[model samples]
Target chain A: MSLILARIDDRLIHGQVTVGWSRILQPDQIVLCNDTIAADPWQSKIYKSAVPPDIDVSILNKESAAVFLNNLPLECKTILLVENPEDMFDLVRRGVKIDEVNAGGMHHSNSKYEMFEYVYVNRTDIAYLRRILNSGIPVNAQSVPGVKIHTIDKLALDAIESIMP
Target chain B: MINGLVVTHGELGVELVSVVEMIMGPVSGLTGRSNSGKSVSELADEIKELISSDNDCDTILFIDDFGGSCANAAQLAGAAGSSTRILTGVNLAMLLDFVTWRETMPIDELPRRLVEKGRQAITSMGPVQEG
Candidate 1:
């Protein structure tokens, strides 16, 4: 597949993606899709610097990312990254064919409830995640390679039921 | 004073800080962080918090290995820019040079100096020929 992995991590490009997943998937390129970060030159530079020089890095907004993913060469093994479920949903809606989605890291905040040790979500996040799961994409949370992958569907369902008004 | 933070796997960061302090005599604003049981985001958050705590001082993150978790976390912290710098392949000599010259040396120049010191400390140490 052109797209080897699609991950939703608030910290888009980091050790987990660069070292953990890269070692396992060994993708030819990493594509980071975020409007804000793509616009900021400094943030783009920081993300690019995190990855080794051997692999290609693309920092593109959602629309550009959709075009890039659609026409990606079959030989190109690309790992797609978005900061949140909303962005992931947007990409899916934009016709980016993804087999599975990895909810890598959301982190804890006052507004977010813990789904896993590393994954956190709130009502709005759950809503976006539900939409993504409803679209028939499997979402799993695994912080690093060689760890148990927690299916996020059940957790999202449970979280949705708990926070119901 | 420019702050220094050493990040590594296991107890290396903590031990490095302790050893440096033992030699330098209780230097302030220099600390260490470990990536044990912590995700990249968690470690990045900690680094960001430490940097934010000392907003006035320019902070330098010394990572034990390049392309490792510590270096990745430092990059994710988004603290690499004008005020904050991330230096990989950290060693005792670099930390020592950092502690010695941080107060007086310009922040931009200190990274190069520390790297030079670290590189200079490594040698073949082979038996010398009798002269």
Candidate 2:
């Protein structure tokens, strides 16, 4: 199955993902893989409510997602939604092919370093993305499609290290 | 061309204006005034001056809270003779509605339309209860 897109957005299934990115990607199903959401049925149900009527939504954890992605047919068009860079790398290490990564939205925690507007990253967070980028998989930071896509290159990653631990 | 003015206790007016602009593009004929250090009378006078100055279009005042200082001031500021009216609980959705329908909709019906917009925007997104 063709993995149409893999997006790392904390707000897994919101307007930006539902309306904004879905308009561009138009995948058959949106598989939101998050540890917390997978465990909490209430959270999963809430997230699923945001999905469009025509499309499918799957809320799975990292292991289940890897298994599902591995088993899909070559023609299956699915969009993988990961909450953080760590989970993204988990899928990558599990032999999932990710052509590109889109960083949609990451609000600030107490210790987060604000990389861009509405995007925050910690030391470990940026490190994970940097690892993926070093492997030649480019991470493009764009909250919504049709907006200016900022390539998460060496310069952008280096800037975050200065402000945060 | 109805001129819209937002008056709030603090930065809600400014924040709401920013949200409206962020969703829509750069807009004109709309302004936001925050009551940081001004008293109720001073705020009322400030809004009154703005309402008086712009006689070209019907000015609509959108305040933060109902039955509060901001709302009372806005009500006092808007002229009774002219077509100046005040709308309370001015959220982004309401402002967007006003921005979209300001040209076509008359000043008399704009409040009801905007109030409906604000009401419709708030949804209990959880599972619906079957009757």
Best by DockQ: 2
A44-121, model 2: which lDDT tens digit per residue?
877887787888999999999999888877877788899899999888888778889888777889888888886899
Highest-scoring model, TM-score: 2
Q: Model 1 chain A — which ten-residue stretch has the worst lDDT?
A: A156-165
What C-alpha lDDT do the candidate models reach, one value each?
0.86, 0.82
Provide the lowest-lDDT 10-residue window in model 1 chain B: B122-131
* Clash-forming residue pairs, model 1: none
Which digits, one per residue and each the tens of the lDDT, describe model 1 over residues A1-165?
A: 889999999888876677567766889999999999899887787778778777899999999999999999999999999999999999999999999999988998887777777888877788888888889998998876656788888566676459655
- Model 2 regions lying over 4 Å from their true place: A1-6, A14-31, A49-57, A62-80, A90-100, A107-114, A142-150, A158-165, B1-4, B18-30, B36-60, B67-69, B72-85, B92-113, B120-131
Q: Model 1: runs farther than 4 Å from truth?
A: A154-156, A160-165, B1-10, B13-131
Candidate 1 residue lDDT tens string, B1-131: 89999999999999998877544445689998899999999999999999999789999999999999888889999978899999988888788778768999988899989989899868765543322
